[model samples]
Target chain A: MADLLQTPLYDFHVEKGAKLVPFAGYEMPVQYPLGVMNEHKHCRAKAGLFDVSHMGQVLLTPKSGNIEDACLALETLVPMDICALKPGRQRYAFFTNDNGGILDDLMVANRGDHLFLVVNAACKDADIAHMKNKISDTCEITVVDDRALVALQGPDAETVLSALIPAVADYKFMDVAIVDYDGMELWISRSGYTGEDGYEISVPADNASVFVSKLSENELVEPIGLGARDSLRLEGGLCLYGNDIDETTTPVEAALTWAIQKARRTGGDREGGFPGAEEVLAQFENGAPRKRAGLLPEGRAPMRAGTKLFSSENSSDEIGEITSGGFGPSVNGPVSMGYLSTEYSAEGTKVFAELRGKRLPAIVTKMPFVAANFKR
Target chain B: MKYTEEHEWLKPEGDVVIVGITQHAADALGELVFVELPEVGTEVEKGEEIVVIESVKAASDITAPLDGEITEVNQDIVDTPTLVNEDPTAAAWFFKMKLKDASEMDGLMDEDAYKALID
Candidate 1:
């Protein structure tokens, strides 16, 4: 624990009575006194401020002083069409290994002069190292370590943000803009992991605490913790990096084909030059053997991670295992995601999860269990 | 009243002893959404898992503190699991059991001893 790092808002979290736990090499707040359930509901109804500063932020600048060159270099690493990404727009993308396995999922924003990236906290070091080893000569990778990211999310997020910066109201989903907040420049993005209308603000570490305090001062805004953050994203059908999507999982198998733009796929100008393009494109044409699907347990009992899944007809035959599962506060029942054999991945397919030595009935349901309210 | 390291509490009320999780356990478990208690008349051994509690985050098992036959179970908690978080010590007792051997209570910690262990 001595090696655990502290975020800029560590003191504020402690003052608010957060239960700190070791996460991604940092002592992060898992939950507050309001409890996970209450905090989850509060976020859906109003707004919840989350300390996401643990996520990695990096800037990529081209050595040739051309943004297109930097975008093309990035295209070699991921399957997304980086050149198609317009300035002040963000897109969801992931790094792929040679075998087509997902290295990490991230957000890529084309910021006119340079590309801004936000990677998962746990995989930031590896992702940065991979990029540097692969493309450092063509594009300079600068890790932005002096910033703290906070997300204000919910149905009322726009209203609350408008009160602070009236210009934010003009921004739509996936929009990114640099705004001046009280003499400090903050990178504001209309994007978040939670499937709600929200904003992720990247602020200077020195100004993070004050900015968070000011945002939380609103009556509708409450400071959320990692516990609720996990449940919220789970209900929203978003994949957790290490759990749902990992080194062994590919973007196609994880049902994230939407993130891969048409320009990079087959029948396009740049048809499949990224890593694992051959395997990925083949999977696209022939289909994957297994697929990630949502699971809805029949009863209130939760089927957690590592729980083995069996065909409803036979208890002895194991077909898959739960990757991420918990009681979804919004769905009011146990929700889970796992890789099932392609035949069993269809919606409403009956399945069984082994829990406490008993085989409980479950159904393959469409995620998210709760509908996303993104301002698309 | 006595407590176990597993956080189950026992109160002697004549022939049958009442059982419930401690307040500390409830707080740590957070707001319980569901509870599955052992059926009445079921015999359970000490250290055997007899109750299952589910929160929004995860599910946990509550073990039996002593060898006993469950004489009664609180149906109120089965209907409203939040009672476990609201008043775990009193109204939300899980079950009442007829002890197979009352001497097992001696191995349990008293209130003050349990407080020290948790603190």
Candidate 2:
């Protein structure tokens, strides 16, 4: 096994009573003394700070100094409308293979002169390699290794963050800003995976500790770990890369068609040019065979990941399996998300999950099991 | 009271023994959100999986520590699982069972041995 790497806030996490665990090649705090349940509730009620520096941050610059060239070049890899993305705005995107399966889901921001992207930690190396192998001839791909990424999530995130970087208050959801603080450049974005309104900030490595420390002085901000992070995102109905959607799961099957802008669809301005355009665009018009659905277990026992799903109580045929399942502290019950056959994927349909040799009833429901609080 | 390597505690009271997880096990599992206990009056052998516990992070199972027939199961932990975190060895006792062979209790670890194992 390779030695696990520590983030810039490693010492800070230890001092704050974090339970460090190995995750995606990094020694990340899985939870603090505050525990996962309270940390999840705290993020919904107030604010929670999460260390996400292990994720890959990359910059793509066009050699011709033209942003349009870079956007068009990137459009060939992802199915989103990169050409229409305005400056200082970020959009969700994913790379697809020839089979229409997702390679990785990422956030791409138009940073005026260059395009900035944040990819998943486990898929970072492969994503960067794919980019370099495909578009390096037209654009310069630079791996950003000198910054620490942190997310301040919850209802109080705006008020708490604006006090430190005053300009953050003006940025709405999905808007990005470059701010100068203490002789360092901080990249801030008003977006997060947790349904709450918040910001994901990229701070220079040298000043990460002090920057996070200053934010923690606020009573509303608590240091959350990977445990709460998973639960919060699960409750928000957002997809975790490997768990919810993987190499075999397509954007249409994953219920991520919303991320695919209309311009990339069958009858749009720039259509059918991405990697799996033929298969993906077809799924958009004629629905996919199976799709992701939200599951609310009737009982308290959580139907964890990999639990098999059946159409009826006594059916022996397996229809699908749960991707993510856990206790939603905000909803005060067990909430889950999984893929099901299109016929069984309706909001009010009944499905049975097999647990401990017994089939338990679950209802297919519309998700964001907790309502989203993003600032428009 | 006797301890199992799996971190369960057994307290003898006449022919029936009260079974619960130790504080060390509770701390390791974090906050318990749900617990599924076996039915009372069911006969079980040692090491049979009988209890299912779900914390906020993951799900785990607790097995039978010794061969016995379940006499009573704790409904408090099932209704409110966090009680196991607050008072694991006492108020959060999972089930009471009458041992088939009481001599099996002698093979379990004492407090000093359990403490040394955790240390």
Candidate 3:
């Protein structure tokens, strides 16, 4: 346990009655004294602050005036359209290995001056090394390890933030801005993991604690932990890095094709350049062998990752595996998401999930298993 | 006749020894979101795990109160987890078993003794 890292707010969380547990090699709060269901529902209804300081933040700039050339160089690595990203907007991207498996998924925000990236905590070190090797002297990549990240998420996030930092409300969804709240400056992004209107603020490590404490001053804001974050993201049909996605699952198979730009799908202009481009392109044209599907479980028996998925029509022959699942507090029932064969991937299609020794009835459904209320 | 350090409580009735988690154990677990029950007729040793209880954060195993063969198991506790948080000493019994370790029961703690053990 000594090997696991702690965030800047680690001690603060312990003081606030947070039950810290190990996750992704970090000692994070699984829930507070209030509990998981309450924390989850609170974020959907009001505002909740999450200490995401464990995520990696990096800064990158073009070698010359050739930012597009630099973006293309990186675009050769991920399938996302880096060249098409507008200033102040962020896009999702995935890293693929040689066999079309996903390495990790992250958000790359065009923070006007350069680019601000938020990658998974578990993969950050390796991801940084990979970026350093692929990117040359033509581009500069710097790890902003000195910064601490906090997310204020929910429907009233903007209202609460605008009261403290007036200019924050001006940005639209997926847009980012750098602003001054009181005397300290923050790089604020109108984005978050919970399917609600929210803001992710990046502040200097020294000020993160005080700044987060200041936000918690509001009666509406509570400090949320990783447990609620996991269930909340899962209820929103979002994937966990090691569970839902890994070095063995491809972006196309995971139903993340929406992240890939249309032009990039055909490998237009610059072709066959990225890792697994050949295999990824073929799956893009021919359709993938398996696809991610949301499961609405028949009863309250919560299915978890690695549980076998089957179809009763075929005598319970295994068809897939549940990658992430739990009782969705807002939905007031059990929900799950995982990959399934193409023959059983259609939304509304009937399937069965093996729970304990019995086969529980399940049906394919559209994602965000919980409806999203993000501010457009 | 007794309990384990894990706070599983047992009371023998003829051949069957009724089992449930202790109030001390339930208080620490908090909110009792999920409970995993053992099947009927399963033989359990004196120190073996027989049932599982999960709060939101972690999972804990309830060891066999005494070596026994499960005769009856509770389905109501599985349906309503909060019973463990509410009436842990009564309606929250995990199962009823034929005590195979009746001679070993003297080693287990009583309610007052269990409370003192925590202190």
Candidate 4:
């Protein structure tokens, strides 16, 4: 068994009687005493506080006047439009490798003069190493592990955030801001994994306890663990990094081609060379063989990951596999998303998943099974 | 009344045995939220895990006390899991299974013996 890692809020979780479970090498709270179902419903109805401090936070600043050149260089790694990223804004992007495979999907925020990146904890070391090797020494890359990440998510998240700072409300979706919450400075982003109106606040590790305690003091807020976090993100149609995308799946195959700008993808605007460019550009022209699509199982039963796929209502040849699947509390039903054959990736297309000793019927649907409530 | 080492408490009820979780087990499980009971007529071997009871924190398997076929199931706990917390031995009766080996209960720990196990 691997050794379990502890977050800055680890003691606070133990104090709240949280059931700690090993996840991504960290001994994180799987659920509190209130359980996954209740914690999930609480996030949808009221507000939920999550300790995401396990994710790595990094800062990068250009050497002199090469911010744009550096931004373009960084864009070569991920398919997202980094050059267009305005100051005080954030964008979702994946760090793709030479084969167009996702090294890790991360949130890259352009913080005024510098850059703020939040990557998955499990893949942070590899990501930093890869960035350091690829970028010029002119760029400054510093990992901010001293911060404890906390997310206040829900419709009332804004209300609590507004109380913290009046100017926070002005920030739009995927935007970042550095604000002083009392005496501690925090990097605030209007981004969350739960697909709700929420903010991911990065507080110094030393100040995490008091920050979390004070945040929970609000009557509307409650501590949520990874159990509810999974269910919530499942409902939101968000995929887990290791399960959904890995070193083999590309941006085009994952249906994230929107992140790649046309100029960079094609040779028209001096097709800047990048890793997996040839394969990705080819897939852009002649579509990918498989694509990511949402699955709506016919019955109430959830179609979990690794569940084999068939085309018949009962039995047929195998086609694809479920990547992420679970019960969606808001939908009050089970929903799933997975990679499917391009021929069957259309919305409303019928499909079947082979659950334990049974064939569960499903239909392909558009993503965001639960409507996004971004404070745009 | 006697309890199996697996934490199942059973009471003689005519030709069937009424089963409930032990107080010690309920307390350790924290708050009960959902209970998945086996269907009637389902055959269960002695010491086999026959029920899936989920609490606020985690889901646990409740093992069968003796070899038997389920005669009846209690649906009340499906909606009200706290009944196990309130009265685990009586009001929270899980199900009744007709015994294939009636002498199995004799080998289980009696009330005093079970109390010692808890202590």
- The local distance difference test score of each candidate is 0.92, 0.94, 0.83, 0.84
Docking quality of model 3: it rates as: acceptable
Please tell me how candidate 2 rates in CAPRI terms: high
Candidate 1: clashing pairs of residues:
none
Q: Name the candidate that leads on DockQ.
A: 2
Give the Å shift of residue B67 in candidate 1. Answer: 0.9
Candidate 1 residue spans exceeding 4 A from truth: none
lDDT of 4 by residue, A1-376 (tens): 2588889999999999998888778999988987777789999888999999889898878877656766776876776668788888898888888887889999998876777899998999999998898875657888897899999999888888777678878878888988887899988999899989999999999999998888888899889999899889888878789888898898888888777776677754636367787888889989999998899887655677888887885666777999988667678666889998899899999988986456778999998998999978
Worst 10 residues of 4 chain A by lDDT: A263-272
Pairs of residues at least 3 apart in sequence or in different chains that clash in candidate 4? none
Candidate 1 chain A has its poorest 10 consecutive residues by lDDT at A312-321
Q: What's the DockQ for every one of the candidates? A: 0.77, 0.89, 0.33, 0.24
Models sorted by TM-score, best on top: 2, 1, 3, 4
Among these predictions, the greatest TM-score belongs to: 2
lDDT of model 3 at position B67: 71
Q: For residues B1-119, what per-residue lDDT tens digits would candidate 2 score against the true structure?
A: 99999999999988899999999999999999999999999999899999999999889989999999999999999999999999998899999999999999999999999999999
Which residue pairs in model 2 clash with each other? none
Q: What does fnat come to for each candidate?
A: 0.78, 0.83, 0.11, 0.11
- The TM-score of candidate 4 is 0.89
